[model samples]
Target: MGRLGRQDVAIPDRPSVGYSLLNMAPKHVVVIIPVFRDYDRARQTVAAILRCSVPSPFSVRVHVVDDGSGDGTAERLSEQFGGRIEIIGLPENLGRSAARNAGATNISADLLLFVDADCEPSDDRFLAAHLLSIREADVSMGVVEGQDDGFWHAYQQAARVRRDRLARRTFVAHFTTQNVMIDARLFNSVGGFDEAFKGYGFEDRDLAIRLARAGARFTIAPGARVIHRDTLDLAQVCRKMGEAGATTSQIFASRYPFEYRTLGYEAIDGQRHPWRGVLAKLLWPVFQPWTQHDAWLQWRLVPFKLRAGIVRIMVAVSYLRGTLRRHR
Candidate 1:
């Protein structure tokens, strides 16, 4: 996901063919999975990772940070995994970034791996592939494949298509914490994820920028893929994009103004393009509902391109309206 804008992150130059093996593959990895209210999903993910055919099972420790679920999740996991996994139950919800930071405390592992609760590895060799990737770079980010096909799945799969053109090793500019590993010391130095980012979007990229600036090499672990179990519709995606614009986008805009402009967010700036806000305001009511349901997602009566165009317009409207509302 290295989305380096023309003037965004500037990673240090690497030798030809990208990665220069940093060091011999190390042992001891801490896999951190942050869980919210989904105990069953979290349980399955932990079980899957534990079952993976890692080189050294004793060297790897799995830590689950139950983010204020307040349920019996911790106890259940303890009962199931026994001494195999550790559970850190937070008192209250600290959001994604803070929960991850909580999980990173007092780590004894040389490598810190982060995987989302909603995702599980494709196969048992997943852990081994990540371990091998760290031989070439400071950070190793695995790929993601969507499950239970839909528009959201297609969108995620399509977004990954850009990776085919990217080198196996590059900067972490295009990163997703869903399934990634980083050097333990390197992660601590960067101060982990910014807790200021309250919602989705930009948080991973922000962390990537800091890591890249700190001279961290990132490797794309294509073989260590994870299956994203969450199914999404147009409405959920739009809601998230809108929330991102209102919350994370503001923080990002303040921090990286130029890069924000490069992402085409400037087009939605109501202060400059007032007409976009006006147009968005008019269409949001009608198109927003269309985005909110799977019924309209059906292209039986409509051309596929036409449906896609409408979805894009509504998503842009959602984001634009969010930015405008936040600014106002």
Candidate 2:
């Protein structure tokens, strides 16, 4: 019935950080979802989590942080879930990392599960899987499956392959915040997510690097899966890829220089194949004729693989351009 903002909630003091699981109880879990403007998707994600039947040993609490959506997101969610879920509304858009940190700070639970508003749990056993996995591992990173098989979907699938390959050798290589369960103490100790990443990328990997440095062991919870309901068309994908490049140049490259190299910026260098950047840049002029503009390019004509390859080159050029811009 009432709206809750950032200043309204208080984060309790935490105990000293330690690696031993015995020091903390893992029964109490708080699932934090940070939403920005996407009201319908957030509602579905919350509904799916509530539908989950977590066993008695585990008590679950759901908290939705509306990051200044200004789209009646808080009102809609409150009307739907009411007292069942706690909603925290910020005065302005604080980005995903800051929003999640704010939600984490407000709850005093043994385990903190961070799930994006765009993701829906695959099954009712979603929380159960993370719970079971955390018994043996400190931080459990779950799987994210794309709901559609579009260009962005194919790109995500390929990226997942690389991530999976890396995950086999070590847990520190790739960390996505989409569906992850982490110990509250460990999360708080590592200072949650780096708020400096004010945009749409790399905050999770930055947190992973810090968590690894803090001796937190990361493991895959294959059973805990979430369906990514949000799909990006080619234009949206390009914009996101550009954002990724910009973030890497501004934050990761300077903050975590060693880990930045692992991102493989060189593999997709458009400078080597000049035409890649030239052609991608040409999209602006090529699509200008269409009144609907970017929307007109959404039609899937080329093979997904070929489109993905071209998009990758465009993303690479965007990244390099972003890096250069930051330096300037």
lDDT of each: 0.77, 0.73
Query: Estimated TM-score per prediction?
Result: 0.88, 0.84
Tens digits of per-residue lDDT, candidate 1, 62-95, equal 9999999887888888899989999999999889
Clashing pairs in 2: none
Name the top lDDT candidate. Answer: 1
Model 2 spans > 4 angstroms off: 1-17, 168-170, 266-303
The deviation in Å at residue 76 for candidate 2 is 0.8
Model 2: per-residue lDDT, tens digit, 1-328? 0111112121112212455455555678999999999999999999999999897678999999999999899999999999999999999998998899989985679999999999999999999898877776578889999987555566788989887565444344447899999988888887999888887677887787776666565667899999999856555655665676555445765676445554565443344335654554666444324323434334577666766565565556555544433432
Worst 10 residues of 2 by lDDT: 1-10
**Candidate 1 wrong stretches, greater than 4 Å:** 1-8, 14-25, 56-58, 162-173, 269-272, 300-303
lDDT of 1: 0.77
